[model samples]
Target: MFASSLAVVLLTLAALLGAIVAFAWAWRKGHFHVDARAATLPFDDHDQRVARPWETPSQARERVQAHGPPLPPGPGEWGGA
Candidate 1:
């Protein structure tokens, strides 16, 4: 029982130490630094104007006002497999 408890404690400490080291390495390598452009890397022009079918005319107008006119979806752009 004592051996098992000690093993668990040692493993927990090792995992904690590993996480700390990984975080320090990432920090030193500037992995945490993010610019506005880099933050938008996953999105494109199409992502800016996705049509929401459920929106009422007023809601559509509000969306257009907030994000400019909505662009028509290209062929196969819909999630149909």
Candidate 2:
């Protein structure tokens, strides 16, 4: 049991050290750099998608009748007020 516990602790420490080294290497290599081009990746020409408009009151009522009332807003959603 002592050997096994020591092995577990050593493995965990090694994994954490490896992660830190990798992060430092990436930082030196500018892997963490952010640019406007990277920010627009999701909006590239190949992936031009738009959100549909919100449901009207009548549509919302129909949805309630067909599929039960919509779920209440989850945590942090205040419905803009």
Off by over 4 Å in 2: 1-3, 36-80
In model 1, the Cα lDDT at residue 43 comes to 68
Error of 1 at 4 (Å): 3.9
**Whole-model Cα lDDT of every candidate shown, in order:** 0.80, 0.63
Query: Per-residue CA lDDT of candidate 2, range 1-81, in tens?
Result: 466988999999999999999999998999898675778665533222222136677876775665554665444443454
Tens digits of per-residue lDDT for model 1 on 1-81? 466988999999999999999999998999987675787677676766766777798988886887788987666666775
**TM-score result, candidate 2:** 0.39
Whose TM-score is greatest here?
Answer: 1
> Among all windows of ten consecutive residues in candidate 1, which has the lowest summed lDDT?
72-81
lDDT of 1 at 58: 94
TM-scores across all candidates? 0.45, 0.39
Q: Under the 3 Å rule for N, CA and C atoms, how many clashes does model 1 have? A: 0
TM-score, candidate 1, is 0.45
